[model samples]
Target: MNVIKRATAPTPKFFKLLRNIGLSIAAAGGALMTAPAGLPHGLVTFANYLIVAGTILSAVSQITTLNDE
Candidate 1:
């Protein structure tokens, strides 16, 4: 029988997004540290942008449920 379960399942998307963002930030930070302070590029920038957009969309789509009395 199919039954409605918990609201949250294993958040693969979120975790993957977070991981990509974190790695990008780390790479960007490292680049800036050693490159005489300038704008970073490559995967770092792309990943950062994608991460922020994904997070915003995800949050926007979230729905809250009210308990029945």
Candidate 2:
């Protein structure tokens, strides 16, 4: 199947949960990154990593599909 098709296809329950979690993680990271002064450098770096990891997790989860029995 094509990328679009696979992405739009139905995802498993577990993956749906994972995708939601990933999205939440990304959102949290974004908020952290956008926060005003006083934020530690380490937190900013962690937020960047969170964004990357969340993006990857959500993308992978979104493309997963159930196999035909």
- Scored by lDDT, the top model is 2
Model 2: per-residue Cα lDDT at residue 35: 93
Listed per candidate, the RMSD to the true structure in angstroms reads 9.4, 0.9
Q: What is the lDDT of residue 34 in candidate 1?
A: 59
**Candidate 1 residue lDDT tens string, 1-69:** 112332342334555466456556555555544555454577456656655665554443332223344
Q: How far off is model 2, as Cα RMSD?
A: 0.9
The global C-alpha lDDT for each of the candidates, from Candidate 1 onward, is 0.48, 0.94
Maximum-TM-score candidate:
2
Count clashing residue pairs per candidate: 0, 0
**For model 2, what is the error of residue 7's alpha carbon versus the real structure, in angstroms, after optimal superposition?**
0.6
